[model samples]
Target: MTGPGRRRAGAAAAVTAALLAAGCAGEPTPSSTPEDNRVFTNPVIRTDAPDPQAIRVGETWYLVHTNSGGRNVPVHTSPDLVAWTAAGDALPELPAWADPGRTWAPELIQLAPDRFVLYYTVADRASGRQCLGRAVAATPLGPYRDDSTGPLVCQAELGGSIDASPYRDTDGTLWLLWKNDGNAIGVDTWLWSQRLSDDGLRLVGTPTKLLKQTEPWEGSLVEGPFFHRHDGRLHLFFAANAYDRATYAEGYAVCAGPTGPCVKAAENPILRSNEVASGPGHASMVEQDGRTWLLYHAWPPGQEGSTDPGRQVWLDEVVWSDGKPVVKGPTQGPQPRP
Candidate 1:
């Protein structure tokens, strides 16, 4: 963790770093009780970081996001979830079949002891399609490279697939979930799930459709499905609407098992645009210090009544009230950090 004084004196990049740090850099965080250490502010990182996904390795946390250009996926590390610093690009280069400047939603997961997997979406230039690819590395913060020259999954008929996420059940069954992008072709996006081999490099089962963009709040898209099992039920948190617009929001569904016959929660769009922020969606959830927290991207308040050009990453606590999950924010003001 970075000290308050040193963080305040660091460069402009340091200021962006402080926005995501644990304590208000020079201001004292309330420490009246053990819970006080979890208090911090929002807008964890004020840069254009979208579709943020994270994994906890031992005592450290590593996060990766949608980096369309530059190197492959970039990694950010933090001792406590509140303070984060750019580690480096996870994948040194793109796969030979995909084009650069098109990586989206890079997800990191540890399959076994020191083995980690990096799943991401990239655009194929030759075919003009978007596809999902997987890379492997020994460490969470990676210099991961694709073991194969081709993508692990691609939907040529439906155009392509994006937002690849892996879900491991209590029974140790690995499942891969992703969306077959149909928005451009005038068809609604479909969320699909299939079983993955133990190594996470091979698909083994039949693909099942989970949900699609049918609700009015979801607009024309429903992508980025995150899976979590709690209270004897499987919950899938997904983002809706256009990623670049103010209507983007997150909704969830409750399922009987890993592959369902799932049903959407009646109270849809659990997190949406509020007065302080806009376009809050495409989030990743993690458990830290025994509390669950959400990391998502939202556009800051725009100037002259126009939306901000870049989306910034924000973190908030997820509290279950009366056994139902609720997000504590879309907070613009300083709040307790995770």
Candidate 2:
């Protein structure tokens, strides 16, 4: 995106010291850069940021990812991908209505300079109810508070919601997409969407079933539905399978129209990992400075490779070739958003 700004001198140094100490205690040290002139970058959001979402504001970049623990969801801000600092959680404490483990796929879209509408999967799994939830805050670094105590929306039992994402189309139509279990039909998971109210907290109408998995490589978990409009078409990107191996991938469906009965692109699994980076999915796409970037999580070689803690926040430049986006291999050094 842009070059990093100078931290507030002493105060930043102090906070950086505290965060670095907390980070390095059990986190992976900045990996060595490859000898082939690559860079070795540490972390932007070091925690288990399962669903990393990115957006660029003015010259500064902002990121938020899922915090399954119901703690404050993690947020990072920086001018460039390098030198990110903890901005603060959207909510340090969950609101009274938000039950335990309700936060998943915390995504933000800048409705205005100071206001943001965060869409997430908030549920009480124990009660067998799942729904899409919303929070609004005056600032990006949220202590986001939910105005609704009950679910903004809910679905059936086995269709328990997860991995939700947001997209605002060219016409200013707000859309929300989420995953519902597909185990019954023998598919991985199904992607569904609905138009959201202008405020983002209400549904304009019921969700329309968009696409399902039929490709062999996508496995049985066709989840993580996020739509990025490129060229004149819409690319619906999602994850498949258990996100713990190279097979864990991001698949895409191409729609001639923004909202569609789109077909999976022939390219299919557009973003998958190899031995270099495993289980890279649940990605968010942001176009900044005439460039596209995909922010997701993965297990780097020999570090945090265990699936126990699941995935962590990661970033890579998305190369455009033949109209589709190819997320490059893991990045070690900082790169401009361009």
Candidate 3:
């Protein structure tokens, strides 16, 4: 296993090379200059950082992903989103209800300057299903603590719940979106949403069923639901198909509100498998300098399930055309930086 120090050193060397090339080079050519400081290439994080969720706090960009490398929740940090350095595990210890080695899809939300809540999916030993849990910390890169005796959300009848993403609407209302793990038990997978308490430690009122898998490309499941409000509209983005297969892709829907009557876009799979990358889904969006970028993971072409490099992190530009988001990637070659 690679130590955290070694990972950081390797990332620093890559950044140094990128900076030097950008500084010394005159004009960028296809062969001579593939990447520069102003530009970047795919697989920004060339490790197993699947189900990536990123949040920008101040000027620093902090990212956390599914359990990998023996850590409960592997965390990384970036300044410009191109070069990333490993920051160790965010959730170092699991709660009493959770079983070890099954933590996944950690999503972060900052309520106050001193309060950060991390919602994560973990295996509930008592319920024998994957369930949702939340942890509290004072900073982005946290040794978050979950002291709850039970899960925050676990729809065991619908095969439990995972991929808990938090969203704060324009009206100052907080909502949580997630998918029932029905695919785990041969049932229908539905994206659901409900209001969250002000402190973000508990759910409020009743949960609404948002949407489900009906498109051809979606196959039997739809997970990783997140909300992005643009142009006075609430758009729900999700990943579908088997996560470990090349057919896994991303799509979106337009919703009426936080608890929506959502309509799927005509362009169902806005992002899908390409020659450069495969299984491109499970994304989080970040805005910097008025530009939107999608931070997601993809398998290297023809290596859909390899554990060596695993699902590496990739960044792509989200260009809005006629009020709809069009991802300009699974890009292989160099493109302008965020």
Each candidate structure's count of clashing pairs: 6, 11, 0
Worst 10 residues of 1 by lDDT: 1-10
Q: What digit string (tens of lDDT, one per residue) describes model 2 on residues 1-338? A: 00010011222234334544666412333333455224535344454456678777778877776543324466777666544555656766655655644456778887877888887765544445555678888877777888776666665454556666878898888888887754433434668888888878788866777876678887666777898888767888887765555677776888765458788878767667665567677788877668777777775645433533345667777877888777775655555434
Q: Please identify model 3 stretches exceeding 4 Å from their true place.
A: 1-35
Question: Which has the better TM-score: candidate 1, or candidate 3?
Answer: 3
**Candidate 3, residues 1-338: lDDT per residue as tens digits?**
00111223233334333533555211221221333567777778776677898898988888898776567887878777877777778999999889876777889999999899999998899888889999999999999999898999999998888999999999898999998988878889999999999999999999999999999999988988899998998999999887778899999999999888999999989999999998899999988889999989888888776664667788899999999999999987878878
lDDT of 1 at 49: 61
RMSD of 1: 7.1
Top TM-score model: 3
- Per-model C-alpha lDDT, please? 0.75, 0.64, 0.83
RMSD to native, candidate 2: 7.6
Better of 2 and 3 by lDDT: 3
RMSD to the hidden true structure, all candidates: 7.1, 7.6, 6.9
**Model 1 TM-score, 2 decimals:** 0.86
- Comparing 2 and 3 by TM-score, which wins? 3
Ranked by TM-score, top first: 3, 1, 2
Q: For residue 39, what is the lDDT in candidate 3?
A: 70
